[model samples]
Each structure stands twice: as C-alpha cells, then as structure tokens.
Target: MTEVVHYALVIAHAIESLPLSRAKRQLLSKITDLDIAGRINGFGGCIAKNKTLGEEVGLAETTV
Candidate 1:
C-alpha cells in the first residue's frame, strides 16, 4: 500500500514536471499508466526507476 502511494506520487510528479503541451501530456499519461501497471505486477523496479526518471526530468527527489 505504501509502495503504491509512493509510485503514485512519483507518477504525479513526473506528469507535473512535463511541459504543458498536448502531445507531452498524452505521452506522460500513457507512460505512467504502463509504469503503474508494471509496478503493481512486480515487474519493474518502479520506485527506484521512477525516482531516477523524476530526477532526470528535473523533479525534486521525494521520500518513498
């Protein structure tokens, strides 16, 4: 449950960090959807990967 919330925040932050452009918005939505599913299914190391992705996109680091 905590991990789900953490990943949700990371996804939200990633979406918020994107430019306010339609194309980027759509892309972010799709990307986050997939990421969330993958994380929920225990596929990708989503928490760490999302943190890295957020940093790469200039979002501040957040505690999980």
Candidate 2:
C-alpha cells in the first residue's frame, strides 16, 4: 500500500503540468492489475531494506 502511494505521488509529480484531478485520473487509468501485482511483489524488497535500517538503528521490527 505504501509503495502504491509512493508510486502514485511520484507519477503525479512527474505530470505536474496537468491539472491535479486530471493527472490523478489519467494515472489511475493507466494502472492495470498486473502492474499492481508486480509492485506488491517488489514491496518485499522495500520491507527488507526498511527492516535492515531499523535493525541498524535499534528500532522494533516491522512487517508488511
């Protein structure tokens, strides 16, 4: 979920020339189920990195 939010924000920012509502609608229209599944798979890597950083900083463990 966080990765999706991050991707959406980055995509929206990249198209900042467009109006906010249009940009969001356009971005959402382009997304497909496969795209979301791929991102969800990739989120494991993000979680692993976050866990490593948390360990280094002596923070509690987290999970997706």
Candidate 3:
C-alpha cells in the first residue's frame, strides 16, 4: 500500500548512509509492521488509520 511504500522509502533514505543491496536493504529497513504500527500509535493513531495494515498492503491511500 501507499503507507508501506512511503515508510519503506523513508526507511531507505534514513539508512542511505550504508551501501546495501535493494532486497537486503529493504529487509533491514525499519518499515515493519511492529515499527510502523508503533509509529501510527505514537502520533495518537492518525497515520495508517483508515485501513488495517493487511488491507492497505498495496493501496495508494494506505499510509501517512
């Protein structure tokens, strides 16, 4: 979903300091369900709010 992509890109940029393969780098990204969910909850649950993470997995209006 849009949320996942946005989060993934953000994670990727944050860690751009390290040189890494795309797949591996993605794995190392802090864009997991736990972390993303925590982020959503941390801000009073505004981001990633409408759809469940699963449902929003590949949608355009999925994330913050």
Candidate 4:
C-alpha cells in the first residue's frame, strides 16, 4: 500500500513537471485516472518506456 502511494506521488510529481500547454495539460491531467494501484500494476509494463519516450523529446525524468 505504501509502495502504491509512493509511486502515485512520484507519478503526480512527474505529471506536474511537464512543460505542457493548456490543451496538453488537459491530456496529462487525465493521468489522475491512473491511481496508485494502477501504477504499481502498470509501472513495469509501460512506465519505464514512457520515461524513455520523454527522454527522446528532451523531457526530464519527472516530465513523464
């Protein structure tokens, strides 16, 4: 449970760091739909890849 919350905060912190426009922010904010448990389950599946994607675009670690 604590791990879930930890990753959620990490995710939320990551989302908050994005350099997004209002339209982009709307899309990013939808990430809230993917909560702590969701992240714990899905983190290894795609989250790591997501970090790589952000890197490709010059985004920082927390930007994803």
Candidate 5:
C-alpha cells in the first residue's frame, strides 16, 4: 500500500509537469480521484472483514 501510494504520487507529479490543456488536466484529475476512491473502498472492505493493519503489513512483507 505504501509503495502504491508513492507510485501514484509520482505519477501525479509527472502529470502536473506536462503541458496539457486545462480540460485534459481536469479529466486526468477526475480519473485519479476515482482510482483513489476505489482503493479506499477496497481498504474499507478489508477492515469490515476484521483484518488489522498489522496483519496487512505482515502480508505485504511476506509477499515482498
């Protein structure tokens, strides 16, 4: 999750530096917002399943 967030931030910074039209920038921003919302909703579902943050971190570490 930390790596994913960091990657998203890097992509956003890259997008901001591009010479895009206002409409294009707004469209990209909306897409980013939707993606973030989806991630948050998925995270919320994990919490609903009674998974703790420590368990999530351990799972991530093992996968790495």
Candidate 6:
C-alpha cells in the first residue's frame, strides 16, 4: 500500500513537471488524487480526506 502511494506520488510529480496546459494538468492531478485516495483507503487509512495536495504528498512520503 505504501509502495502504491509512493508510485502514485511519483506519477503525480512527473505529471506536474510536464509542460502541459492548465486544464490537462488539472485533469491529471485529479486522477492521480483519486488513485492515491483509493490506495490509502484500501490500506485502511484515510489520510487524504480534506487535505491539500502538498499535505497529502507529505503524508504519503512519511508513510512510505
């Protein structure tokens, strides 16, 4: 589960670094967020609830 979250974060960071349009970036971001949230929930945790991207990433990193 931790590895899954880490992988999702890595993918999210990669997406963020791409020179994409704002709309496309946001679409990818939301998709990544859903993936991460689902992974965390499957792990019997809910760290992503109401958290900002930075906050969620921080939690994911620490958990990993």
TM-scores of all predicted structures: 0.43, 0.21, 0.29, 0.31, 0.44, 0.46
The model with the greater lDDT, 4 or 5, is: 4
Off by over 4 Å in 4: 1-10, 35-64
Tens digits of per-residue lDDT for model 4 on 9-57?
4534666688867545644544454444456675532333446545544
Clashes of each: 0, 0, 4, 0, 0, 0
The candidates, ranked best first by lDDT, are 1, 6, 4, 5, 3, 2
Local accuracy by lDDT, each model = 0.55, 0.41, 0.43, 0.51, 0.44, 0.54
lDDT of 6 by residue, 8-35 (tens): 3444277879998765676557656676
User: In candidate 2, which residue ranges exceed 4 Å CA deviation?
Assistant: 1-48
- Stronger candidate by TM-score (1 vs 5): 5
- Model 3 agreement with the true structure over 1-63: per-residue lDDT tens digits: 354423321344564567876544444343354465555455422343434433444333333
What range of 10 consecutive residues in model 4 has the weakest lDDT sum?
A: 44-53
Q: Please report how far candidate 1 places residue 47 from its true position, in Å.
A: 15
For model 6, what is the alpha-carbon lDDT of residue 6? 33
lDDT (Cα, tens digit) per residue for candidate 5, span 1-64: 3543412222547657779875556555544555555556554222212133224333332322
Return whichever of 2 and 4 wins on lDDT.
4
Off by over 4 Å in 6: 1-12, 43-64
- TM-score result, candidate 5: 0.44
Model 5 superposed RMSD (Cα): 15.5
C-alpha RMSD between model 1 and the true structure = 9.9
Among residues 3 or more apart in sequence or in different chains, the pairs in candidate 3 whose N, CA or C atoms overlap within 3 Å are 1-57, 1-58, 1-59, 3-63
How close to the true structure is residue 63 of candidate 6, measured as C-alpha lDDT?
27
